[model samples]
Target chain A: MKRLNKTLYSVSLLAMALALSACSHDDDDNEISEVAPPQPVTYTYQIKVTNLTSGQPASPIAVALHNADMPLWTIGESASDGLALLAESGDNSEFLANTALLATASAEQPTLPGESMEVSVSIEDNAASTLTVAAMLGNTNDAFTGFTAMDLSQLEVGETSTRVSVAYDAGTEENTESAMSVPGPAGGGEGPSEGREAHDFVSMHPGIVSAEGGLSSSVLTSDHRFDNPVLRISVMRME
Target chain B: MLRFNSKGFRKTVLATALFASAGLAHSADLEVTVQNLTQGIYFTPILISAHSNDASLFELGETASVELQAMAEGGDISGLATATEALSANNIANPAEGLLGPAMSTTASVTTDEGNDVLSIVAMMLPTNDGFIGLDNWAIPEAPGTYTIYLNAYDAGTEANDEIRGSGAPGEAGLPVPPPLEDVVGNNGVGVTATVANDSVHIHPGNIGDDDATGGVSDVDNTVQRWLNPVAKVTVVVSE
Candidate 1:
């Protein structure tokens, strides 16, 4: 009886192998009939930015996915006109229209202090290995906080990466903190005036010297001052 | 028995060779760029070192070593460089050769020796009592790639931030005003503080410069000399 059981088991294994081969053969026939151009895959990313400041409000967050060939802004280099517009005016229209961007998205409204906003961007058929996110600190003169050319190539689907950002001076305009130069609620002044009047190169912001901090001409008060890591940004690959 | 001994010796030699090759594989060539991110603050000569993971330049919440104090207070990197060299560290001292001005960048190349898998950088910020930009024992990645790190200012805990013109010696009371900064920094100011409150390395409280260039409470200029955190940006490119 044991010998008979072993023979029967071997016979069943052979039959199963034959059945699997037959299924593969059917799949091959179907594949040949359906062979066509490959469909493009869409890669989508969800970006969430949280304002961690006490008083400073963030401009509408602008996010871009692109190759690593160019960064939105480089330290010690002059800010592009597009970046200057966004940093000084909180408008991202020109920035989003850059030719190098693979995909772009922006928050519909400014993110208030201690609040969070999420924006999604999608690209098809190409890999976006670099990501750039930026926003203006609405109360300052040409002060913006965000990161540029952050590597997103290693990010996998359903994976998230979080980072805190420091403030950068666009250097396109002086940090006058005067009511006429600041465009935020504190000053309600005109934004993005003509010319690169300051150092004309991007650098870390020296922070605000409010009226309380001895800038007698400053329209800002102590409440408008902030420190580093002003914005907490998180990016997740959704598809 | 003789044949067995010979075979054992051959195996030992092969293992030794493998270990030697592994050590060679761990070494890396690094091109490092240090950019003063501050709009106004200047960095003294920077010291970049590639050492073992066991060593560090400065530790937070701990008393700074004498070498660290000298570098932080006086922009003297010789002491720290000597200390690290004793540990077989590969060091590039004074990469900027002098004060690195605001928004300026300097690059240095170093080929790390065996076991030197971590990098440390330190530079004193001008117009501060004992504040320094520090990157403590950042592990160098084995894979070839570019890495960016932002360095924050630290208080060496060895002097008072008087914001006055004083000696740069250890246990000093004020900042070292170099010739270039003489015109920008203020003078004849009462010191900000007289005591070292922390007495241990910590994050800098930042400058409290009054706009009075000649007779404010502090000699530092609030608008021109004061800076926020992350005073420097370091870019490291790793190669074989």
Candidate 2:
């Protein structure tokens, strides 16, 4: 079995247990019930994504919560301009600013391979509250991975769920595998260069074949070969 | 966890919703769907199987079995198929019938035989020395729902990823360029590495390509052929 990166899970569990246990000692039920329509409380969530890949660093994550039916990206569909930017350049600026979100958050730096970090957002957590998180696999062209519109309404005050995500091709750029095309350290070239050539439909990523394999023009090596489940994501309701 | 909260707004409400736990305790029918999640990599024939707890196709940190090496090195799973069949594993072989192109998908239904409580899957990634995507010893929840799992790239550690043209036969040094791949992959000038650093099954480090399509260090296109982890997505829907 794989050893789970569950420190964040444990902390959320402990906090929830304490919150629930606190009620057991109180006889203030009558007092609590006497209060009139209570004010809506703020709900906060913490999402920690660990880079499970051996060499791929994760672009800083872009996170959003919405009470509306908003999908950040869909398989078989072309990417929105904002999403395309995030996927190709590892820049979450435009994605985080989209108007559909009730709350949003982003990471300031890239999450290096074998490292884990947290990016969080808080919202009303009301009906229709759903989460969308996205991050680019920094070493590739237009490949991003994350989940969108995961229902958050049902999770209790203290519960955590971990999900593994596979890479997705934004279909915004052609996979060129050249030193001047990839924006990561492997390519060290331009990011999100103009002139798109793909059909522009999102789909499962087709992997890169570095110079070590067959693409003699590629700047990457065997060390850059990766598989699915690039990210191990844990979402916890913090408050 | 159900709680009765009287926080000033209640007539009595269950403010929390429960997400169904994706586990079970019995036999099931599964509709397994797998999608190639990369832009440049192709998947060879896929092998999906259900077996007992004692059986696993591969384990991390372990040496590659001869059968596994055959698939990783040459895109052949016949040997492993025979070995698993002898163990009473229920399998669906080559759901796509041939090479699954980039970003494509294949679906198949598998009914678990008695005592076959675990599921596993594997497929070779084309244009590589010994790279494959696989799932090993995943416990099928006795209960039924849609379960999604992602697969990572793995190296068979059997050959040096020289990135040059070579045979797919066991103990070969370079990748096998089939007719379809022959057009996409570049011709070699030099190889990448001469040795395998970790001579055991392990996570793939990823690919590195250059720009010289005709002649350079590799035949791969770094802009077109590179990728990240999570090369595939597997969705298993267990009958309710």
TM-score, every prediction:
0.83, 0.69
Instruction: Give me the runs in candidate 1 sitting further than 4 Å from their true place.
Output: A1-36, B1-27, B52-56, B115-117, B141-144
lDDT by residue (A169-235, candidate 2, tens digit) is: 8998876667787888888777686755786778877666666665656677777766777889999
**Each candidate: RMSD to true structure?**
8.8, 10.1
Whole-model lDDT, candidate 2? 0.80
Best-fitting candidate, measured by DockQ?
A: 1
DockQ versus reference, model 2 = 0.27
Q: Write the per-residue lDDT of candidate 1 for residues B1-240, one digit (tens) a residue.
A: 764565466457646875343222246789999999888889998999999888899999999999999999999999999999999999999988899998999998999875788899999998999999999988887667899998999999999888899988887678888898888788899888898889899999999888778886799878668788778889999987
Ten residues in sequence with the least summed lDDT for candidate 1 chain B: B18-27
lDDT of each: 0.88, 0.80
Candidate 1 chain A least-lDDT 10 residues: A1-10
Candidate 1 predicts chain B with a TM-score of 0.89
